[model samples]
Target chain A: MPLWDALSNAMRMTRKRRIGPDQAERLLATGHDPAHPELDRLLAAATAPPRPHELAGLDAALAAFEEAGRTRRPAPARQRWRVLRPLAAAAATAAVLVGGVAVAAEIGYLPGTDRPAAHEQLGSRAAPPSTAESGHGTASAPAGTVEPTHSLPVTPGGTAIERLCRGWDDRRHKGRPMKPDDLRELAAAAGGEDRIAAFCAPRLRPPGNGQAPPNSPPSATHPSPTLADDGDDDDQGEDGDEQAAARNKKKKKEDE
Target chain B: MDDEELAGALADAVRGDSAAFASLWRAQQPALLRYLRVIVGESAEDVASETWLQTARALRGFTGTPTGFRVWLFTIARNRAIDERRKARRRPEEPRDLTERELPGSHPDVANEVIQRSETDWALSVIATLPKDQAEAVTLRVVAGLDVAQTAQVLGKRPGAVRIAAMRGLRRLAEHDEVRARRAESMPPIDLQSPRTEGV
Candidate 1:
């Protein structure tokens, strides 16, 4: 069979111990295969240098690679923001919880508002000396300082809802409805005080647009807050005279 | 590039300097393209482009000397060629006409015609006829000018395996009548129409 002949030929080829690559290369350079001199011709032919034309298209290829590299260099900053935005939002939510919610909201530090615009509105009146004015000092100041120009952290609605629910908890404990405020308005929009918790839960877990409830009218200070109109004089009702004076100062600025 | 120039360019390239990258590309692209041609045939240009693009993107992160860069570049190119082959297998294209066969001793003046056919083309054609592993071994060793260890690194094989493959491939090329016919001045001319003992 042809298989037997092939096996015999392979055996014969192997019988003359196979030429090492190094030895073959050496023979190739010399232009003579010591064992099979005839093969020297083939080795010499195969070893000929490639033509200059072989290097064609190289310049254009490198140009294309450089073009791609230029475009890809700026991508890391955008990628980093994609990872950090949510962590910032979560940190803001946790920070709002520790600070007194009613005082924070009364100073126009409520959530569901454009942060920079709210900071802009709050900027006109000097920030209150009270360290418990946590909403403006802790939440808005850092965001303003870090990314003062970029309109990135527009999701103050979660903070607004947290402030509202805290107010609802206070009203339930005191057995009295605190004078009409943003929390009261948000609760009313949710249909009742009982529904305030449910209403705030989804808003706290902000969706993509970061807007408050669609039906709630935009407030004077923050374009997104639906409860701006309800909390006008409630600062005095909740925090007595001094906080009310500060709220009056804020209201004057919003009106102007 | 000499080792000093290559090392400096490699260091600059790792720092994302485009000029350094271009210098490295100019020095290495010829061999890389030739090696790709041997393996991927017509699509070598596209595959080489993909390989360089990936290399450029990852240039900043690579940490090695110039010689290591060659191994890494070829490894990426070989992987890309393998992927192209697999894709081609899945969606088969119309077969090209292969009717024009080169008969042994067909040329009247063998030595002249051998010189006319550039060695790269002739050698690649012979290599294409070889088994895949042997062809890769020979192309990486001879065309790419990689040492045994570097060729083994590129091929993802043991150095011994790479050596054996290159040895077998060179032996086969030596035995091939077409290759031997090119060195007509040193040996008696072969008659393709008749069979005779392969006289050394």
Candidate 2:
């Protein structure tokens, strides 16, 4: 028997015989079942003053939440408002779009549709051939028209006029938004005098409103706003002069 | 509840399920409070509250067995005790708060009451005087009732370290008790309960 058995056993009954920390720890860890006097103490200790009680504050917190539920008052309405808030905004936005499109159609603003003359006034439809038929079939080409001297540097086999025409033409062909820089470069290279190119610009009359693009002069001649221009549209149609104003407005807005 | 059901509840609690959390509080609060009482001494209530707050904060997905749950709870209690000790050290020494925590195995019969009470109280008081390693070992083995391995798990100390602590703690208690008894015997009994008659 171990020398400490009597003391250990007595300690055990009084709850002090559990194995000391080291041995129990070793036994627990290594599976080496060492004797535990202290563990005995612990078990004995466990049996002390045996009564259970509720926590001090648990009842209070439960009551607060309960009362909040009973009142049907503060948080739910606030939460409901919060939850429905985004829903309400979405509904309003839908209403505006449906109502807005109807209002716009009433004013004959729907594209390419037959409308009353009063509402169609702002449309940029191609003009009738009579406007350009001022006798240009054989003689629209003046004595100066055949001269290539007015053209700027174009690639080999490509004339300046052809290059100039490609700038606006490519924009339309590509269906890309024409940056102001493109118009400026084209205008600068084409070197002034041909106001026709400026007039054919699509911005002459905005679809939604009759407002013209801002900061844009009546003609492309007033210092091209952009530094880079790709000459695409070769010839400005007869209504080009009228359309230039609207084109400039849209272009200016694009720049902004 | 079966282990699975209990594990599920604990897992849910860990996952922030308030109902599961309430269940845990209901199930473990009593034993936990008692453990807290002994561990933190006087301010067991404070320590217990702090323990709950911390447990609530750190709760995550744990599927613990009953033993594991007790270990977890006691680990929390142990940490709070350490914090309390640190806080107390920052102030002056005060009398221990006797919160009458009921230990499951600590009570003795009337015949043994005087001796056991004196021994246990003396053990508890002297426990703090032991080397820290020894004190922890002794507390786990003697007070907390953890086996050596479980105590080792709680403490992260080697089993050897724990054994040394208990041995040292026991020796210290024996020494302290001997000294007290000797002192008591040498001195004349000063009985305050009896009338303080004038010196004859």
Winner by lDDT? 1
Worst 10 residues of 2 chain A by lDDT: A150-159
Give the total clashing residue pairs for model 2: 65
Q: Give candidate 2's whole-model lDDT.
A: 0.45
Q: Find the candidate with the highest TM-score and give its number.
A: 1
CAPRI class assigned to model 2: incorrect
Off by over 4 Å in 2: A1-43, A46-49, A52-256, B1-9, B15-23, B26-39, B60-69, B97-129, B142-145, B170-200
TM-score of 2: 0.37
lDDT of 1: 0.55
How well docked is model 1, in DockQ terms? Answer: 0.10
Q: Score the docking of each candidate (DockQ).
A: 0.10, 0.04
Docking class of 1: incorrect
